[model samples]
Target: MRTTHAHPIAAALAGLALLATLSGCAGSTAARSDAAAGGPAAPVPAAAGAAAADEKAASTSEGTAYAAPGASERQLARTAKLTLVIPDPAKAAKELRGVAEGLGGYLLNENVVTEQKDGYYVEPSTVTVAVPGTKLDDALDALSKIGEVRNRNVGSVDVTTDMVDLEARIASLRASIARVQGLMDKAGTITEIAQVEKELTSRQSELESMLSKQKALAGRVAMAPVTVTLRPPSVVIQDPNPLWQGLTAGWAGLLQSLRMLLTIAGALLPFVVLGVLIWLPIRVWRRRRRPNAPGLLASVLAPATVDAEDVPAAKPLDAPRDRPTTVDG
Candidate 1:
């Protein structure tokens, strides 16, 4: 019975050793799916979104180029500042309002100031609007009719590199996060689970931050700003100097000088006090160690000396030594 049991135990041990050797030779099966291990790379989803946007933009430009023969309509994405001077403010305003409404563009901001000049009227206006890239030309054409078009300028910035780089970074982070999630699901040990959770949290935060950056960039590219400044045909004159202007200016100067003085004092007072405090200790030490003057010396040293009248009379030492002392029985 002992021999039979030993044989079974030895067989089981041999089987376990063989299995471990096979597993060691095979290495990890997980590496088959990992791109770093000679595997095919995974598709980047965020990159696809950016690529689609570029394709759409290209298609849009082509469509606009072939819209009509001898058509001046162009698809442009840029920021512009326009200044217009018209004879009729109300009429121009009404006409531009219809054009803006028809273009699907709305006024983001508007300001109008009306004044009387030489018993006449003058209106100065400012409006900030955003229009679609496809309808920019139409919007600008309609707005130019409102005034003399003093300034028709546009500024553009190319963010292609920035946007593409951001997309790539976002995609990489998302891939890393997915891998971490898988690891978290498979992790059985407490240490491994904790590590995966920490990594996932970091990746999630980074992705959110990158996403915000992407949105801000997209908003900037999608909507172009057009600043329209409208002024009256004629100039308005005003008094060069008001009555209370000089007085107010003088008062302001006085207050400014007072503040300057106060600031200087605030900055210098600590150094001044520190210098005084430092000088005080040196002055005390010098006084303590100073050489005495004639009067001061006399006053300080006179008590240590005794006058001849206050001294006790001294016996003659030579006479006492000359006489030998006899021994007493």
Candidate 2:
């Protein structure tokens, strides 16, 4: 200890200063790290978790909201008026009604009229029925047995888009309303509460409207209307007295034709007489204006050129060729 050399005070002061500077730099680095951890711009782990949860909830809600209406919409169905023609209308009507009943349907309207042939036989009758849309094919099959199906028409309209969209909107609005109600309950401030309440009211109104539209769509999809027309079966009637009937018809037709012809002739008689009266004067005038026949010589007279050529033509031709100035040939 007696032999150790003492350090200079200035040197000791410089060493202490350097140590203090290094310490200050380390402290500043630690403060900067702590500040970065608690800074306003830094990502908050709790906030990130909450944001992820909110996003998941929104995605789920939207998925539920936009879902389409189910199978009924996918399975579009419709029926159109079908017409059948048969020879005998009355029998066809009965058969059509039976077919309708057989096909799980009912006759909505029935009309049959037996037009008589010479007030003797039933001509035909017609029947109309209302059948279920699903049973239309069955009804048609059964009707085919009764008579021929002359016409068939099927039609459908698309309302699925509207129905599906409305249903989705309804679900979404309901979910949103519920969410808003939850917010309203948790909201402490009056301003937030009021805003949530307003949003809830609007959503509720939209929900009601969507529900109304859904009901209307449901009604349309539930029942389908089918129209069926029945024609009578063809019936051939043979009369033993066909000859008599034919003769009677022929006589009647002949009489009718003669009567018509006479009537037409009588109708045209006045016009024919008037036409004759108009033509008489014109004929007389034409006849009067005709010239009397002339003498045979005058009637057969030749043209001036031919006559001039034929009369001493040799001498005239020679003179014209020689003396053009004397006369015009």
Best candidate, lDDT: 1
Tell me which residue pairs clash in candidate 1: none
> In candidate 2, what are the lDDT values of residues 1-329, reduced to their tens digit?
21221222222223322332333233344234323432343222444334434743664465443343553746344556667666666666677677777666677666677766654435334456656656656665676666566777767667676665565445434433444444444455555556557666765676677667666665454434556565454456776697898999999999999999999999999999999999999988986876463455675795554556667745444444564557668
| Model 2 CA lDDT for position 76 | 42
Error of 1 at 63 (Å): 23
In TM-score terms, candidate 1 sits at 0.47
lDDT of 1 by residue, 74-104 (tens): 2234787889986655676666667777788
Alpha carbon lDDT of each predicted model: 0.60, 0.55
For residue 23, what is the lDDT in candidate 2? 30
TM-score of 2: 0.36
For the record, the alpha-carbon RMSD of candidate 1 to the native fold, in angstroms, is 25.4
Sum up the clashes in candidate 1: 0
Using TM-score, give the best candidate's number.
1
